[model samples]
Target: MKIKLLFFFIVTLISLSANAQTEVADQPAGLEGLISSRTAQRKNPDAKMDGYHILIIFDENRSKAEAIRNKFIAEFSNKYDADVIWDEPNFKVYVGVFKTKLEAQELLNLVKDNYPTAILVKDKLKFPKI
Candidate 1:
């Protein structure tokens, strides 16, 4: 009778441990699903599309252009919440998608201090649909 009780206790402990582990394992899938769904929503442009737009043109031949681009990204990433992208033939950096030209111009003035040669241009920004 004592041996039978010990065996039953071991089995109960193992079953309880297995159930606890399953509950913990189940948590990450829900969190991962939430993250993946949010990412999918962001990929849907129709879900959210409205912001400032600005273009920055850099000297393609200048070696310092890359350094300048990095600096601009570091400095403005949080302050202005800008997006910097590299377009072929030139390192094209763009800030927010402003509703009006004036708003873009204002941001240009703020960023130009760091990048003296940076100038504003008109070009449509493109990002791969996620």
Candidate 2:
């Protein structure tokens, strides 16, 4: 009986081991070439996409814009991101990286009481992490 039990156990183990082998799926044609070409070209690390931001302040004075940016950072930095961009002669202060105009509008509505002139501006935005 012990001999029969041991033989059954060995047979089960062998069968299980045999079934454990995985088969590799066939790669589609041109996938390897595409991957190689992509690797050669190299992707941008800081990839940006078309998005919207709340234009909080746009002024000709850099100092004024910087001051408003600092104020915004102090008040709402936890909720949103803020930046002071130099667009030629004027300094523009923007907030939030919204993927859609509706999302930007939502935040804009909330902040409208404080910044009455806040409007949504479409621009390149940092890609969100998964």
Candidate 3:
């Protein structure tokens, strides 16, 4: 019984030692540069831009869009990112940066009464270049 147990312990130790091997791989030339470039891309803060935003209103008149934005800001206690983007003939007023559609939907329900046409849109938002 002792001989069997001793043999079992030796086998287990040998198996464990054999399994503990360092991982190493050889890559083609230029692969290291590609790998570093990929890391650099991930390190950039602005690489990720998928976020849900609410389009408060769209109008051909810039003044109308600005007025709506101001009114919305004045009435709402929370601060929102307000921007006017020209989409062809019309200027779009977008507000708020929500990480998910569910979050935007919750706010949309509340703001819908004020801006009946307000809808959620996926906008790629980046931190303004400082």
**Top-TM-score candidate index:** 2
Judged by TM-score relative to the true structure, which candidate is superior, 1 or 3?
Answer: 3
Q: Tell me each candidate's TM-score.
A: 0.42, 0.64, 0.62
Task: Kindly provide the TM-score of model 1 when superposed on the true structure, using C-alpha atoms.
Answer: 0.42
* Model 2: per-residue Cα lDDT over 1-130, one tens digit each: 9999999999999999999859988899999999987665445566678899999989999999989988888888557888899998889999999888899989999888988889889988776544
Native-to-model Cα distance after best TM-score fit, residue 113 in candidate 3, in Å = 0.6
Candidate 1 per-residue C-alpha lDDT over 1-130 given as tens digits, one digit per residue, 9 for 90 to 100: 9999999999999989887644433465579889988889767665653444555555565455555556667877645434445557665555555555687789878866665655555544433233
lDDT scores in order = 0.61, 0.86, 0.85
lDDT of 3 by residue, 20-112 (tens): 968887799999999998788667986656789899899999999888888888877546777788898998988888878998899899899
CA error at residue 72 for candidate 3, angstroms? 1.0
Off by over 4 Å in 3: 1-48, 127-130
Local error of candidate 1 at residue 67 (angstroms): 3.7
Candidate 3 residue-wise lDDT at 60: 96
Q: Which stretches of candidate 1 lie over 4 Å from their true place?
A: 1-52, 57-66, 81-86, 125-130
* Cα-based lDDT at residue 111, candidate 2: 84
Candidate number of the best lDDT: 2
